[model samples]
Target: MSQHVFLRGMVAIRLFSALAELTGALLMWRFQRLETAVRINGLLGLVGPLVLTTTMALGLAGLAQSRLPAARLVWIGAGVGLILWGTRR
Candidate 1:
Protein backbone atom coordinates (compact mmCIF):
# COMPACT_ATOMS: atom_id res chain seq x y z
CA MET A 1 0.00 0.00 0.00
CA SER A 2 1.06 3.57 -0.53
CA GLN A 3 2.33 5.77 2.29
CA HIS A 4 -0.69 8.02 1.94
CA VAL A 5 -2.97 5.08 2.48
CA PHE A 6 -0.99 3.96 5.50
CA LEU A 7 -1.00 7.45 6.99
CA ARG A 8 -4.70 7.86 6.45
CA GLY A 9 -5.46 4.49 7.96
CA MET A 10 -3.37 5.24 11.03
CA VAL A 11 -4.94 8.65 11.56
CA ALA A 12 -8.45 7.33 11.01
CA ILE A 13 -8.03 4.55 13.53
CA ARG A 14 -6.68 6.93 16.16
CA LEU A 15 -9.54 9.35 15.58
CA PHE A 16 -12.04 6.54 15.91
CA SER A 17 -10.36 5.42 19.09
CA ALA A 18 -10.56 8.92 20.51
CA LEU A 19 -14.20 9.17 19.57
CA ALA A 20 -14.92 5.86 21.27
CA GLU A 21 -13.25 7.03 24.47
CA LEU A 22 -15.15 10.31 24.50
CA THR A 23 -18.40 8.51 23.85
CA GLY A 24 -17.64 6.01 26.56
CA ALA A 25 -17.02 8.79 29.04
CA LEU A 26 -20.21 10.51 28.05
CA LEU A 27 -22.20 7.32 28.41
CA MET A 28 -20.71 6.62 31.80
CA TRP A 29 -21.66 10.07 32.98
CA ARG A 30 -25.12 9.98 31.48
CA PHE A 31 -25.98 6.63 33.09
CA GLN A 32 -24.75 7.73 36.53
CA ARG A 33 -24.62 4.10 37.65
CA LEU A 34 -21.58 2.27 38.87
CA GLU A 35 -22.36 -0.93 36.98
CA THR A 36 -22.95 0.85 33.70
CA ALA A 37 -19.83 2.95 34.10
CA VAL A 38 -17.76 -0.11 34.81
CA ARG A 39 -19.11 -1.90 31.76
CA ILE A 40 -18.37 1.07 29.54
CA ASN A 41 -14.90 1.37 30.98
CA GLY A 42 -14.26 -2.31 30.40
CA LEU A 43 -15.23 -1.99 26.75
CA LEU A 44 -13.11 1.13 26.37
CA GLY A 45 -10.15 -0.78 27.79
CA LEU A 46 -10.43 -3.28 24.94
CA VAL A 47 -10.48 -0.46 22.41
CA GLY A 48 -7.20 0.92 23.72
CA PRO A 49 -5.06 -2.05 22.84
CA LEU A 50 -6.82 -2.75 19.60
CA VAL A 51 -6.18 0.78 18.46
CA LEU A 52 -2.56 0.64 19.54
CA THR A 53 -1.92 -2.60 17.69
CA THR A 54 -3.64 -1.42 14.54
CA THR A 55 -1.83 1.90 14.36
CA MET A 56 1.47 0.22 15.00
CA ALA A 57 0.77 -2.36 12.34
CA LEU A 58 0.02 0.33 9.80
CA GLY A 59 3.17 2.20 10.77
CA LEU A 60 5.27 -0.92 10.47
CA ALA A 61 3.82 -1.72 7.11
CA GLY A 62 4.77 1.73 5.91
CA LEU A 63 8.24 1.48 7.37
CA ALA A 64 8.78 -1.88 5.70
CA GLN A 65 9.08 -0.02 2.41
CA SER A 66 11.56 2.49 3.73
CA ARG A 67 15.33 2.39 4.31
CA LEU A 68 15.09 1.40 7.94
CA PRO A 69 17.14 -1.68 8.77
CA ALA A 70 15.58 -4.98 9.75
CA ALA A 71 17.32 -4.92 13.14
CA ARG A 72 15.73 -1.56 13.90
CA LEU A 73 12.39 -2.97 12.97
CA VAL A 74 12.96 -5.84 15.38
CA TRP A 75 13.72 -3.38 18.13
CA ILE A 76 10.57 -1.44 17.34
CA GLY A 77 8.53 -4.61 17.48
CA ALA A 78 10.11 -5.49 20.82
CA GLY A 79 9.27 -2.06 22.16
CA VAL A 80 5.66 -2.49 21.18
CA GLY A 81 5.64 -5.92 22.83
CA LEU A 82 7.04 -4.44 26.01
CA ILE A 83 4.38 -1.76 25.98
CA LEU A 84 1.62 -4.35 25.71
CA TRP A 85 3.22 -6.55 28.35
CA GLY A 86 3.76 -3.68 30.76
CA THR A 87 0.18 -2.56 30.45
CA ARG A 88 -1.36 -6.02 30.92
CA ARG A 89 -2.93 -6.85 34.26
Candidate 2:
Protein backbone atom coordinates (compact mmCIF):
# COMPACT_ATOMS: atom_id res chain seq x y z
CA MET A 1 0.00 0.00 0.00
CA SER A 2 1.08 3.54 -0.69
CA GLN A 3 2.39 5.55 2.26
CA HIS A 4 -0.06 8.28 1.44
CA VAL A 5 -2.95 5.86 1.59
CA PHE A 6 -1.84 4.56 4.99
CA LEU A 7 -1.40 8.07 6.34
CA ARG A 8 -4.78 9.12 5.09
CA GLY A 9 -6.46 6.07 6.60
CA MET A 10 -4.81 6.69 9.93
CA VAL A 11 -5.80 10.36 9.97
CA ALA A 12 -9.36 9.72 8.79
CA ILE A 13 -10.01 7.21 11.51
CA ARG A 14 -8.66 9.55 14.18
CA LEU A 15 -10.81 12.35 12.86
CA PHE A 16 -13.84 10.09 12.89
CA SER A 17 -13.07 9.11 16.46
CA ALA A 18 -12.89 12.76 17.44
CA LEU A 19 -16.18 13.47 15.73
CA ALA A 20 -17.77 10.56 17.52
CA GLU A 21 -16.58 11.93 20.86
CA LEU A 22 -17.95 15.35 20.07
CA THR A 23 -21.24 13.87 19.02
CA GLY A 24 -21.42 11.82 22.16
CA ALA A 25 -20.76 14.88 24.28
CA LEU A 26 -23.46 16.79 22.49
CA LEU A 27 -25.91 13.95 22.96
CA MET A 28 -25.12 13.78 26.65
CA TRP A 29 -25.66 17.51 26.96
CA ARG A 30 -28.90 17.41 25.00
CA PHE A 31 -30.32 14.58 27.09
CA GLN A 32 -29.40 16.15 30.41
CA ARG A 33 -29.63 12.93 32.39
CA LEU A 34 -26.99 10.90 34.18
CA GLU A 35 -28.27 7.55 32.93
CA THR A 36 -28.35 8.70 29.32
CA ALA A 37 -24.92 10.23 29.61
CA VAL A 38 -23.57 7.00 30.99
CA ARG A 39 -25.04 5.03 28.15
CA ILE A 40 -23.56 7.41 25.63
CA ASN A 41 -20.21 7.19 27.36
CA GLY A 42 -20.34 3.41 27.29
CA LEU A 43 -20.89 3.42 23.53
CA LEU A 44 -18.21 6.04 23.03
CA GLY A 45 -15.75 3.83 24.89
CA LEU A 46 -15.93 1.22 22.12
CA VAL A 47 -15.17 3.80 19.48
CA GLY A 48 -11.85 4.72 21.08
CA PRO A 49 -10.28 1.27 21.06
CA LEU A 50 -11.53 0.54 17.59
CA VAL A 51 -10.08 3.74 16.27
CA LEU A 52 -6.79 3.16 18.05
CA THR A 53 -6.42 -0.34 16.75
CA THR A 54 -7.24 0.70 13.21
CA THR A 55 -4.83 3.61 13.23
CA MET A 56 -2.07 1.45 14.61
CA ALA A 57 -2.75 -1.23 12.06
CA LEU A 58 -2.41 1.27 9.25
CA GLY A 59 0.83 2.60 10.69
CA LEU A 60 2.23 -0.89 11.10
CA ALA A 61 1.25 -1.81 7.58
CA GLY A 62 3.06 1.21 6.24
CA LEU A 63 6.12 0.39 8.30
CA ALA A 64 6.03 -3.22 7.19
CA GLN A 65 5.93 -2.10 3.57
CA SER A 66 9.01 -0.04 4.21
CA ARG A 67 10.87 -3.22 5.35
CA LEU A 68 11.17 -2.26 8.97
CA PRO A 69 13.08 -4.91 10.88
CA ALA A 70 10.96 -7.74 12.31
CA ALA A 71 12.21 -7.14 15.85
CA ARG A 72 11.22 -3.51 15.74
CA LEU A 73 7.78 -4.45 14.46
CA VAL A 74 7.40 -6.90 17.31
CA TRP A 75 8.38 -4.20 19.76
CA ILE A 76 5.87 -1.82 18.23
CA GLY A 77 3.14 -4.40 18.44
CA ALA A 78 4.05 -5.12 22.04
CA GLY A 79 3.89 -1.45 22.85
CA VAL A 80 0.39 -1.22 21.51
CA GLY A 81 -0.55 -4.32 23.47
CA LEU A 82 0.80 -2.81 26.64
CA ILE A 83 -1.12 0.39 26.06
CA LEU A 84 -4.39 -1.48 25.65
CA TRP A 85 -3.67 -3.68 28.63
CA GLY A 86 -2.73 -0.79 30.83
CA THR A 87 -5.82 1.17 29.91
CA ARG A 88 -8.28 -1.62 30.41
CA ARG A 89 -10.61 -1.38 33.39
Candidate 3:
Protein backbone atom coordinates (compact mmCIF):
# COMPACT_ATOMS: atom_id res chain seq x y z
CA MET A 1 0.00 0.00 0.00
CA SER A 2 2.98 2.31 0.69
CA GLN A 3 6.62 2.58 -0.26
CA HIS A 4 7.77 1.40 3.13
CA VAL A 5 5.42 -1.55 2.93
CA PHE A 6 6.72 -2.41 -0.50
CA LEU A 7 10.33 -2.21 0.61
CA ARG A 8 9.66 -4.32 3.68
CA GLY A 9 7.82 -6.92 1.64
CA MET A 10 10.74 -7.08 -0.72
CA VAL A 11 13.13 -7.52 2.17
CA ALA A 12 11.02 -10.28 3.70
CA ILE A 13 10.73 -12.12 0.42
CA ARG A 14 14.45 -11.84 -0.04
CA LEU A 15 15.11 -13.20 3.43
CA PHE A 16 12.68 -16.06 3.00
CA SER A 17 14.25 -17.02 -0.29
CA ALA A 18 17.66 -16.93 1.31
CA LEU A 19 16.55 -19.19 4.15
CA ALA A 20 14.97 -21.59 1.70
CA GLU A 21 18.22 -21.86 -0.15
CA LEU A 22 20.07 -22.43 3.08
CA THR A 23 17.61 -25.09 4.21
CA GLY A 24 17.84 -26.89 0.91
CA ALA A 25 21.59 -26.81 1.10
CA LEU A 26 21.60 -28.05 4.64
CA LEU A 27 19.17 -30.84 3.92
CA MET A 28 21.13 -31.95 0.92
CA TRP A 29 24.35 -31.97 2.84
CA ARG A 30 23.01 -33.68 5.91
CA PHE A 31 20.50 -36.09 4.48
CA GLN A 32 21.72 -36.83 0.98
CA ARG A 33 18.25 -36.10 -0.32
CA LEU A 34 18.13 -33.11 -2.58
CA GLU A 35 15.19 -33.93 -4.82
CA THR A 36 12.62 -35.01 -2.33
CA ALA A 37 9.21 -33.57 -1.53
CA VAL A 38 10.05 -33.51 2.16
CA ARG A 39 13.02 -31.28 1.61
CA ILE A 40 10.89 -28.78 -0.30
CA ASN A 41 8.35 -28.82 2.50
CA GLY A 42 11.06 -28.34 5.06
CA LEU A 43 12.35 -25.33 3.22
CA LEU A 44 8.87 -23.85 3.08
CA GLY A 45 8.45 -24.43 6.82
CA LEU A 46 11.58 -22.42 7.49
CA VAL A 47 10.49 -19.71 5.10
CA GLY A 48 6.97 -19.22 6.48
CA PRO A 49 7.86 -17.26 9.63
CA LEU A 50 10.34 -15.14 7.76
CA VAL A 51 7.58 -14.08 5.38
CA LEU A 52 5.29 -13.22 8.29
CA THR A 53 7.88 -11.15 10.13
CA THR A 54 8.81 -9.31 6.98
CA THR A 55 5.19 -8.38 6.41
CA MET A 56 4.70 -7.29 10.02
CA ALA A 57 7.89 -5.23 10.17
CA LEU A 58 7.04 -3.50 6.92
CA GLY A 59 3.51 -2.77 8.02
CA LEU A 60 4.69 -1.20 11.26
CA ALA A 61 7.38 0.73 9.48
CA GLY A 62 4.91 2.00 6.93
CA LEU A 63 2.55 3.15 9.62
CA ALA A 64 5.35 4.82 11.57
CA GLN A 65 7.08 6.41 8.57
CA SER A 66 4.31 8.93 8.12
CA ARG A 67 3.72 9.89 11.74
CA LEU A 68 7.24 10.34 13.11
CA PRO A 69 10.84 10.50 12.02
CA ALA A 70 11.79 8.69 15.17
CA ALA A 71 9.81 5.70 14.03
CA ARG A 72 11.80 5.48 10.86
CA LEU A 73 15.05 5.93 12.72
CA VAL A 74 14.07 3.25 15.19
CA TRP A 75 13.38 0.88 12.37
CA ILE A 76 16.78 1.54 10.86
CA GLY A 77 18.38 1.19 14.24
CA ALA A 78 16.63 -2.11 14.82
CA GLY A 79 17.86 -3.41 11.51
CA VAL A 80 21.40 -2.44 12.37
CA GLY A 81 21.02 -4.01 15.76
CA LEU A 82 19.79 -7.20 14.19
CA ILE A 83 22.77 -7.30 11.87
CA LEU A 84 25.12 -6.77 14.75
CA TRP A 85 23.34 -9.31 16.91
CA GLY A 86 23.43 -11.82 14.09
CA THR A 87 27.13 -11.31 13.54
CA ARG A 88 27.87 -11.65 17.20
CA ARG A 89 25.77 -14.76 17.65
Who wins the TM-score comparison? Answer: 2
Model 3 per-residue lDDT tens digits across residues 43-88 = 6766655565566566556756567677676787587558656755
How do these models rank on TM-score, best leading? Answer: 2, 1, 3
Q: Write the per-residue lDDT of candidate 2 for residues 1-89, one digit (tens) a residue.
A: 68999999999998889899999999999999999999999999988888888899999999999999999999999999999999999
Candidate 3, 88: how far from true, in Å? Answer: 24
Model 3 RMSD in Å is 7.6
Residue 5, candidate 1: Cα error in Å is 1.0
Minimal lDDT window, size 10, model 1: 59-68
Which lDDT value does model 2 have at 37?
Answer: 100
lDDT of each: 0.92, 0.94, 0.66
Segments in model 3 whose C-alpha atoms lie over 4 Å from true places: 1-35, 68-89
State TM-scores per candidate.
Answer: 0.94, 0.95, 0.40
The per-candidate count of clashes, in order, stands at 0, 0, 0
Q: What TM-score would you give candidate 3 relative to the actual structure?
A: 0.40
Identify the runs in model 2 with alpha carbons over 4 angstroms from their true place. none
- The top-ranked prediction according to lDDT is 2
